[model samples]
Target: MNPAEAGPQVERRNATAACVEFVQALLERKVVEAVLVPQHVPGAKVVVQTLVTDPSRLEDVDPVAPVLMSNSATMVSSLSFQAPKGRIAAVMRPCEINALVELVKFKQANLDDVIVIGIDCPGTYEPKDYMQIITAHGGPISEQVFESLSRGETPSFDGYELREACRICEHPSPANCQILMALWGADFSSGPVIVPVDEKGREAVDKAGFQSGNLPAHRQQILEKITSERSARGQKILEQFAQRIGSIEGLVDEFAACKKCMNCRAECPICYCRECIFCSPTFVHESNKYLKWARQRKIIKMPVETLLFHLTRLNHMVTSCVGCGQCSSACPNGLPVMELFRTIGSTVQRIFDYVPGRSLEEEPPFTTFREDELEPR
Candidate 1:
């Protein structure tokens, strides 16, 4: 269910059942060439990205299936520019959608040929950590847990499976989706399943023969209580964590455990680059340069780019950071990547009074200049 919905109307449904019905509708219309979503891949213990072209293949369409797999925005960027495909109906979390919008503004992706399918952010488990739990449990525990959770049960924190970044997520739903798979905590037996955020999606739903009904009380109460609690918790974390890592020196100290492992950037969907400049020979300057730095400074961090990479990367994409939490998820050191990036990203975005992926018409701050704006006071 979309927690962003105001005044709290609870809508509930068996997300799996809704998925089957939704995919069937998409298949019949053929408006989308394929639906890229998650499903159990064969005998694998983890969920993998599956492309469904036929309605029969939509059996395991668990809308609650967490995509803490790989970042999809970079893949979309590559698909948008390098290999243009037919219209795709792909479900993305808010971060992915927002990252895609940033990519489009930066001329990284072409948005005209894709249909966005969004769902409410019910939080997610980190990929590697989640897989570990699945491995320990002999297989994926997602389906069972989701079913239980859907019925209004809060599951215990299963080891280190939950992503650290998710502990503080604020915006969980994609508000700008053309087609939103609304999951209000309301009883699913009588509420809207596929709520269209756009007219095209509305027409599509109408053609699919869906009828809206009154939301349920039980579902609404669950959503409101949960989201409200989440927001308060997030604010507290911001305040507490801020006290520790609020300055440049403190920031570097917080990142002291990073081991120069570019895992964070590597996992970030917005950090899409076939050849990172830092990874190039230009950064691999003569050996004497390192010695000179060591001679001058007394010590050189082994990975060389201990501070520059993080800072530059933050500067480059903070305006586009969508708070997907994948960076911290992919980190081996468990550094709070989303917390730092989003904290800065939020400031940068607000400077322009912008929210990424919320619109296509809005240009990025770096791309276009105003003739007469932000004049001297």
Candidate 2:
């Protein structure tokens, strides 16, 4: 049977509970050796990724948490790159899966023994904001978020908004995954729809004993609506952002507050370099070289190369950027790093007709050349 045509046959009352049950089944049935999922911390309101081998440890699991503490692609890379003993299933949001796809292309992650169980994301909040919102509500609001998504609406928290990166995300539904817990246009009263995107996903679902059926008729329609809305919004925002950074002076002014902490690079999942050129001895200039630069320019930013750092990074990874916005979140000075990258990335990606993470078969522009491309007659 075509897995894409198969959907969940079981129904449950609670979406979160249903997901927990499904994941637990994966373990109980030995579909995978371990599962990587998000669970609430014992004494804190924050949620982080946890590796579960024992099914009983999944009591605190919340696969659709509204917070993003860190992009999990780096963690996935760490886990799968070394070729672990057994297969694992990772429950990730759409963006994280997309980032992982890019990492696989760069040889940073191996998906051979991995099963990607993707979840639909309405959007996510910065961790601090999520903590505050949930605290004000007196508990987790994941159910409420899922409910909103089922109605094909963006979930809203009182006194807070989603991260700008999420607000402008074009891909809210999972792709390039084996299994998907589809929420868009769902009747969450019956729980999220479990969708098998390929044969592996179908086998996993069958092994876990979930029956097969057809997906919600309106699921694709609603997903397209959401993507269209976000793409239009993203274009508008990126256009304005590009104008703001249109000139060198403008770009420098926007990034003037950078402390050169490298937090953005450190948090970026696509930046897989073991040692960045900026951190090399070449950039550890001698006092005379600094003096020469200062004398030549007559004036230069102290702790120099801040602008250059951003430019160099953009050159290196812009094509692979998934726009997860961890860089902006990681920035202590609050520079709009995500916006800058997406604005430039969209242009460069368009020129090459490439969308990072869209498919494993499509090569990154930098890694491929075309004889008839980008030439002057």
Candidate 3:
């Protein structure tokens, strides 16, 4: 029997089962040596990226889970850096896939032997918020939330909702991915529609021997509606941030609670520096030096480098920010650092007519120069 037919009866199987079966076929046939996908740990509510070598271990693998623990691009970078002997298949969200594209350009990730599988995102919940919702709902959340999102309704449990990042994301469908598995805006009670973005994906599907079909016409309308809604929401966020940080006082006020703990830097996918300047001795000073600075100002903030640290990071990474919002999720103070970075990033990227992680052929703005580019100075 074909792989699709080998699963449960056509009427009973859902999209999640179809997705798992597809990946299992690849593994069983040795089309790829390992698969990098998210799976809920046994006896845990959290889902994490798991590298599965055995097909039987995929019992808990879920690509459409509403919880995002971390950006998986860095994980892919670590896995493929040494030029692994066999091909690897990875399932990632749109933001994670975008980050991987940027990483590929920076020589941090090798995609020549990796297959990128992207899914139509139905947004995600912040990890802490998701855990709370799961506890209140009293069971696994993937199916429940997926059902709500499939109908274009936001999942709500008590007062909880989707993450701010997901609420305002403009790119819901994956772009520049080799294979795109779609669930949104489709009646997936039958099976998923596997759409190939390139020849590699077409070849992969052929090898897997799964049934495929064209996307429903309504899929385009649904995607456009979602994108438009998200764009409007994103613009509102940018406008609010602009008002909040319109001046030095406002900027400082917004970040006044920052502890200089470097959590944002640590979680940012684009802030990939082994020895970041902020973490180095550049910001470290002697006791007397701190005293001297305080004496000069008569009163200095206890942690002196908060503003400088954030500004420096913005300068270094704003062009590459993919709006993944991991930084804000990692912030202990709950400062909206992602908003600041993305707000500035969108403007900077626009000024240079560049969109980070959109395509491999597009060069980063800072890497190129033209005398006439910024004539006004």
Candidate 4:
């Protein structure tokens, strides 16, 4: 059966409240052992993912919150990498689902006992920026965002904007998930339209007791419009960035302020190495080695291999970069790491005809090789 045809619209007035009720139903009905979802932190304006086993604990749940503290893919990877005894459902944004899909291919996560509940994301703010926006509005702004989506318009705050990664993200709608809480072109006042994407999703919807119905008439039309705008914006921005870093000197200059803090790797969901080469003894050069290099060049950056670090990361996972932009948010020096990765990843992924997080059946380009592949290069 086609999963999209089995649309289950949640019957509620407020979109956010509707999503919360649906998640609560999952717990109350025992659809899964636990649900990993975002909730508001008490006494603060922050939102973070929380694993809930009790339905009553869902009072603060806000699955569509317009802020991303970190990519939840890493969290899902940790929980499902070994296949837990009980099934777990993760509510994640489109990018998080994509990143987790890549991790699954790398043997970093197993989805057998995991049910993915993906959400259609318009965009999100950096953690700090989200706090400010919330304060400026004097409260949570998810409802406002949903209202904007219902009108087929991008959500905009007075003085803030979405992160660059989100602005250029072409995949606003999620794929490869068991279930989806669709928002684009939705009638939020009537509640979010939930679509079951697979057998697992259909079963979950049944267990949760949502009646199957037709999807919103214009959801696809609105999604295509959003994707098109983002793709065009991404192309323009990345093209200019590519030209800016065309030369080795230009690339070096762009990363000249790198502190080598490794924050980018720490935030990257695709960089699943338990012990990265950067953290290994391989990069811990002897004192005399630094002195020797300084003498040879008469000058050198204090943290050697800063450029090498970025390059090595690109080589390792650029093919699987989901463009979540957490790396740029993690940078203390405010470097354009996301732009660099997206620009380079666009080229590399195209060369291999791979889109990270697109599917679980397709092997990553790095994992498989064709005898004639790249022979012309």
Candidate 5:
């Protein structure tokens, strides 16, 4: 379902400042033990995730910091694992929120103790694209890139900064969360902008002393303008990568440089295996085995069992991929891990007529099956 079409309608404006205040209020009200948001380091404008135990830290709350290298989903899971059993309210973009939901379903996380603050993602730049923008803009970053220029109806980098997967994402606004930060006002247009996705989110806003205002039509127009442009870019990407998605051979070829680094699995929010079979000695071969392969095939695939390795993983968790893109980020060889997994994940999830992370009660595809399904004599 379209994110915009599913929620209670309301108005919003100048939410950037309101959001910061809301986080501070959550801290004061003890709604969360800490507020997980990004902050600007004094010397460098590079915004990193900061766990705010005190409301004062919200002064640096910059939700717009571009996150491509790290997945906020993984961050949340790791924090949940390591931190005390207190409610941790985290500010996340749409994809991060969805990833966390999927993680909860996989038993890798618990959402009962967390307050999610979701934002309307305009999109982000790839790692290099962001660096390039910083370099060209004379170091550090200004609010102008995401806060202003984009609202002016022009992306700062002509699609250079957007990750491959985000360009195709049809759902830019968040549909599920305890709180959806309204960005309806403070932009070019005059109309109603923000509203709650559910009763829980609405209550949070109300508790923060926020009453609904007119959501600006210009804000939606801004979103649509970006969406249309990204759609064109997404179509270009599909055509460019079409052949690669055709078969396993194409998929494998795309990973030709993969060294089985397992970084993808490591950074994945949903990968909860304390001990993975691929990481086990079951797949490890001695030097003799590598030499033996060289003798048999003249040249061995350096990683060994690369295709089998990935397929084994695909068999296990392809249906639960939330497309956080951390796998692609962790790939040292620059494999389009997100593209391959999402392509396969979409197909896998569809088999069970499911959308990963949409709801908690839904069982995974492999966890259940119809008795008469797929019967062929």
Candidate 6:
């Protein structure tokens, strides 16, 4: 029987239920040895990534939760380093999927033994903001909002909303992942449809006996609308950033509030390094040097190299940045770190004609060398 014709028989009651059943089927069929998913911790308002080997343990799985405590791509990278024994399914956001693709090109993640399952993400709240919303709701995140999203409705709780990065994200759908859990344009009353985007996903779906269907026609329309809106918003955001800190002096003044704690680097998904040069002894200077600088300038910033640290990070990660905004979310000083990276990184990526995480076939500009690519000054 045709999969689309059989959709009614296999249609799930809700998106969450459909996701749980699909993942459970994958585990039961042994298509993958384990699945990495988001699990809502009991008695806690937080959702975190959990590796599940047992299908029965998926009862608390909520991949659609609006909480982004950490980038899942970095978690996948952590797993990839160990070279796990069997195929592992990773459910991730579109941004996280892109970050994973970039990591694979950087050799920080291995794709041979993994399957990436991406979901249509509208956006998510910062960890703290999500907690506040949950507290106010007197429950876990609202299924009403999650379901409304599938129907193209925007649900808000007072002034609460998605993070800035998510708001301006132009790529809301999956491009690099193997499987895409389609949410938009699907009637939540019938559940989301899972479409395989690659051979790996197709094989897994066939093995798991998932009933598939064509993407809804309205899905394209919805996606295009979202893309247009986000692209415009992204451009406006870049313009505002340029106006605020386009000059060297303006940039210095904006970042002058930096405490030099390196929290942004710590939280960034692309800033992968065992030992950063910023933390090296080379940046450390003798007492006389500090005194000499203070005497020469009458007074100097206490935690020196604040601008240098940002510049070094920008140089190291601009080409690979996926604009996940974890850096800004991690900043203790509320600096507009994400705005700076997205603005400058977008320009750098354009200069190289590269899009981070667009595909595995495209090599990272930093790692590739073509002497004729850039003209000598």
Q: lDDT, candidate 4, residue 195?
A: 81
Q: Is candidate 3 or candidate 4 better by TM-score?
A: 4
Candidate 4 residue-wise lDDT, 159-246, digit = tens:
8989999999998889999998888888876867888888999999899998654578898898899999999999999999999899
Could you estimate the TM-score for every candidate? 0.83, 0.94, 0.93, 0.95, 0.82, 0.93
Cα error, candidate 6, residue 325 (Å)? 0.6
Q: Rate the local accuracy (lDDT) of all candidates.
A: 0.67, 0.88, 0.81, 0.88, 0.67, 0.83
Specify the poorest-scoring 10-residue window by lDDT in model 6: 3-12
How many residue pairs clash in each candidate at the backbone level?
Answer: 11, 0, 0, 0, 12, 0
Instruction: Give me the runs in candidate 3 sitting further than 4 Å from their true place.
Output: 1-13, 152-154
Which is the better candidate, 5 or 6, if ranked by lDDT? 6
lDDT of 1 at 145: 48
> Lowest lDDT 10-mer window, candidate 3?
3-12
What digit string (tens of lDDT, one per residue) describes model 3 on residues 29-127?
Answer: 887889999876665566789999999988877777788899999899988877889999999999999988888877788998899989888788888
Tens digits of per-residue lDDT, candidate 1, 210-265, equal 65333334655666666677668777776677777788788878988777678888
- Runs with alpha carbons beyond 4 Å of true place in candidate 2: 1-13, 375-377
TM-score, cand. 5 vs. native: 0.82
Residue pair clashes in candidate 2: none
- The candidate maximizing TM-score is 4
Query: How well does candidate 3 match the true structure in TM-score terms?
Result: 0.93
Which runs of model 1 end up more than 4 angstroms from their true locations?
1-13, 82-85, 132-161, 188-192, 207-227, 371-377
lDDT preference between candidates 3 and 6, better one: 6
- Measure candidate 4: CA RMSD: 6.5
Error at 250, model 2, angstroms: 1.1
lDDT of 2 by residue, 76-185 (tens): 99999988889999999988999999999988999998999999899899999987776676667778888898888999988898999998998888899999888877
